[model samples]
Target: MTSPRPHERLLASMMRALPESGIVLFGADSVFPMIAIFAARRWGKNLTVVSAVNTIDPRPDFLPYSTMDPPAGHRGSYVIPMAEAYDLVGRGEVDHIFVSAAQIDAHGALNSSVIRMDDGPDKRLPGGGGLAMILRTVSVVDAWKPVHLRRTFPPRVDFVTGVGNLRHVITPMAIMTMEEEELRVSSIRSGDTLDKVQDATEFTLQLTTKESGLSRAIAEPTAEEIDCIERVDPRGVRYATEVY
Candidate 1:
């Protein structure tokens, strides 16, 4: 099999759209989050990458910001509280937030805070600190909806900690958006047709875009931006695979 192309990798997994400024909460080992961090840096948007535990950078050259604290492990949004997340966004320091979800609904709600446990009352994880605050306060967010572009999406979510105003959700197949409280298919992924992308998603969608395909918000890459993404994501490819 042929190796995936750079744009292919980026288009495939880097599906989340970001607000101009905000905080993104993701796991340190998450591949999509890593790609988002790289792309967010290229866009020159102000961002805060929040992890439950401490993370250190070995090759810190690629990231625009460095991770503080040492290698440690913990659970919960132990470092920060949900209310403080409100303070951050309210103070203009944060305008959006990203939380990796285990389930998504047509309305663009995420259920990353809930985890199914064996014979138990479905364990709930601290999805992220400020997702609830970000949604209610920031009024905007970027997310690839409909369950990572597949059947994991449903008519209603199991739980909603943060109902992201879901500015955008990039899937392996297409870009999703909010059209009057409903998630709509705004942009088709390059090399795929609308029907092709639609067939891959679980939720029903309506097209709101005219010329829609994989295009950046800025469209063209700046010299510094290109250099940055290429440095960490060398080969100009983004890693969205679960293995990464």
Candidate 2:
């Protein structure tokens, strides 16, 4: 049997990230970073795509073929700032945001900073880019909205750096979300079960069933879809493990 590919897996992961309505924002290229370049064209067509210049690298087809770039001073329904994406979340211009966390906690707090080890630090990641304020603005306080976090690293986050609307979490093994400050496991990846997910994470991640009973991972990849992922990111990095 053929395995799923990366870009396609990215798209499959993104499809699960979206809401049926309202403004959606993406923080980095790791997930659905921009609307103009939203990566969902291959699986289906006749989909609505909003384009943003100050955002992540978009799918090439969105360029001269399907979508027209936004003109200067255009106000997109949902906005993403390529330069200051984090700031937009604080102001409430975004309803949902997909961000990669250095480490995340059961309480939904994020830590984008690095671990201070004996040798200064092993790596320096992007520090809390407006995450604190965004967390305060997005959490149960501001309209009680939902945020999604994608982190491969775990164990209650080394430090609390950033914050998202923090509705759910997507990892290589599972899908999870917060319910009133409690981390709940959403769903297991397509091929994996809850036990497998628990074994992979560093911390004790609470698993709950997502409303959508599917993993962001391709339930079943098409020959073309699998081929597409190989053509783009041949390494076969799958990002969308959680469908929440």
After superposition on all C-alphas, the RMSD of every candidate to the true structure, in Å, is 6.7, 7.5
Query: Where is the poorest 10-residue window by lDDT in model 2?
Result: 139-148
- Give the residue spans of candidate 2 off by over 4 A: 28-37, 41-88, 118-123, 138-153, 209-218, 221-244
For model 2, the local distance difference test gives 0.48
Best by TM-score: 1
What's the count of clashing pairs in each model shown? Answer: 6, 10
Model 2 over residues 48-75: C-alpha lDDT tens digits? Answer: 3334345332343222211234431144
TM-score of each: 0.63, 0.61
Q: What TM-score does model 1 achieve against the real structure?
A: 0.63
Runs in model 1 lying further than 4 Å from the true structure? 1-16, 19-31, 38-59, 62-86, 90-92, 115-128, 145-149, 209-227, 234-240
lDDT of 1 by residue, 133-194 (tens): 65666645566432344545666777876785566666655567676787777765456777
